[model samples]
Target: MLLANLMAFMLFGFDKRRAVRGMARIRERTLLLWALAGGGGGAPGAFAARRLFRHKTRKRPFVRWLWLIAAAQALVLAGWAMI
Candidate 1:
């Protein structure tokens, strides 16, 4: 989980920096994959990344997908807790 969040954090920061430089961008799909891989519980790493970098917060589709991933992670956590 720690590694997943760290990966998301770095990737998001790198993407934001590239955007500022008008350089090539990381794909949205890749970013979301890291978020989904945020491992087992709580909010996806992208949430922290967004807060820290102000990245993608204004993109409606991306935000929606992030939330969806969070919901799925939360569900998994809940199921685990039930055991």
Candidate 2:
């Protein structure tokens, strides 16, 4: 899980930088893999990158919802870990 989150963090940061160059594809397969691998952190990380960099603002609603979902998933995982 930690490894997955790390990968997501790297990818999210990369995607943000790439977005500045007007590149914003989801890399669907990789995203799905990350999400499935317990890297729910990716969504929020992506959202934050977008917001902080002032990119993808048009997708704000979608990204905001995704971030919320990611947060919920992270909480669930944390709870699971505690148990």
Candidate 3:
């Protein structure tokens, strides 16, 4: 989980830099894959970085899916804890 979050953080940073430079961007699927794999825990940091860097926060699909991923992760954790 820690490793996944770290990767997500770096990926987001890279994507933001690319965006600012008008370079090729990271795929949304790749970002979400990292999040869904366990980096969902880092969703907050990703969001904060998005805001701080002014990147991707306004994309409806990205915003919606990130929240969806985080909510699903929360429910999964909650269920696991209950078990």
Name the top TM-score candidate. 1
- Cα displacement (angstroms), candidate 3, residue 22, comes to 1.2
Off by over 4 Å in 3: 39-42
Which residues of candidate 2, in runs, are more than 4 Å off? 28-36, 39-58, 78-83
Q: Could you give candidate 2's per-residue lDDT for residues 1-83 as a string of tens digits? A: 56665565566567667766887655745643453455444554444445565554676655565556677787877987999
Best by lDDT: 1
Instruction: List the RMSD of every prediction in angstroms.
Output: 1.6, 3.9, 1.9
List where candidate 1 sits over 4 angstroms from the true fold: 41-43
Residues 1-83, model 3: lDDT tens digits: 77667777778889999988999999999887776775336665566666677777789999899899888888888988899
Using TM-score as the yardstick, the better of models 1 and 3 is: 1
Q: Which TM-score value belongs to model 2?
A: 0.49
State in Å the error of residue 59, model 1: 0.9
Of models 1 and 2, which has the larger lDDT? 1
